[model samples]
Target: MAEGEEVKNKQVLFRNYIDGFPKESDMYISTGNTIRLKLPQGSNGVLVKNLVLSCDPFMLFLMRKSDDSGLFGCYTPDSPITGYGVAKILDSGNPKFQKGDLVWGMPGITACAGFYVVSTPKKGETVFVSAASGGVGQLVGQLAKYFPEGIDIYFENVGGKMLNAAILNMRNHGRFSAFDYLVHYSQFYDILLPFIREGKIVYIEDVTEGLEKTPAALVGLFSGRNIGKQMIVVSRE
Candidate 1:
């Protein structure tokens, strides 16, 4: 569609407040909504066409109404569930962004523009990354591989057995970066893009087709049924 045109917005909506482990019944696809392509006058928001979405384990916590202290706001019942996505800007009222700008960031978080500094990895230090195959973990694993001592980083996504094993095998002075405890998205992309372009990183995605499968895909994370990065393909284009 052209710029400033109206389009139907397909969204995954949170059906109710979740408790314990969330089920597929907790969320549903709502495709009856339409949104204008342009941002309202005086609004600083940018309108975007989402291209890719990230499925992180932390999303389960946001689904729970009890967890109000999360850095990302809790999902409201009957509202569209929001998360990080790579998108193409369709229209913008913000001076920093314009139509066709490709970007990625969480719904409530501001996109990081300009350059971000990342710490240089020491030559021989071992790095342990939990959720190594997940969105963030995969990038961390690839970055660690670039060091002279290759694959020294232990990248894991799940806890329990995997985390215990990682702790048991950690070398003295080894560094551990937890996905839930860090905010290094910009730095991650900085290092990740090069590897991606060089074909150094191989990504495995477990995708469920259609927005209707979103809840099932999410619930599968807890059951260990998903392989690699779990995602929902809402559209082919």
Candidate 2:
């Protein structure tokens, strides 16, 4: 790919707002799109080549024409949709990133993305979440390993057995929490801050703060407006 080369940018476009369960017919994949491979003049954006596109359930919520789609907002009637994706930067106008940087984007917490895409966690299931002094959420950094067969992110911490187990027991949208191997003596409650920051776990699950925002927050539980356990705080005191 040369500089400023244009490539076919295939996309999925939602038909319209919905009232119930979204079906395949509600969205259409249009392969007739074209995108330039370079940044616009004076633009400071990075152009990425999406190596893997995750099909998540929150997209269904965004498909609805709603006033409260939380922080992510709603998808346009005829525009392309967005979700968690692993991609390589093809061009960069930002100083922090150079060409060929692999990135996993944000508002990307593990449990919420899981519950939406994979449904509820069950009893007798072996699930592990790592706590690096607690309060960790988001795809803050790219996991050290990338499985080319489409297991988008990974970091080896436990050992080869844990590593092999992860690779073998994979599913679409499966997420692994990061382990801070060095923190051996910290208390459990240290997780509150970052959780409060990015929104996850008990500190945040579909969390909507304040009284004026209560109604929309309530509606979000089943409306795809809320990400995790929906809670509205009228007052902290």
Which stretches of candidate 1 lie above 4 Å from their native place? 2-5, 41-43, 105-130, 133-156, 168-175, 181-188
Tell me the TM-score of each prediction against the true structure.
Answer: 0.72, 0.46
**Candidate 2 — worst ten consecutive residues by lDDT sum?**
131-140
lDDT tens readout by residue for model 1, 77-174: 89988887678888888999988898865421111211122212467555555554444343433442344343334544456655665555655555
- The lDDT, on a scale of 0 to 1, for candidate 2 is 0.52
Task: At residue 208, give the lDDT of candidate 2.
Answer: 55
- Candidate 2, residue 47: lDDT: 86
Count backbone clashes in candidate 1: 4
RMSD of each: 6.5, 19.0
Stretches of candidate 2 above 4 Å error? 106-237
Evaluate residue 136 in candidate 2 and report its C-alpha lDDT on the 0 to 100 scale: 28
Candidate 1, residue 108: Cα displacement in angstroms equals: 19
Q: Assess the local accuracy of residue 145 in candidate 1 as a C-alpha lDDT between 0 and 100.
A: 39
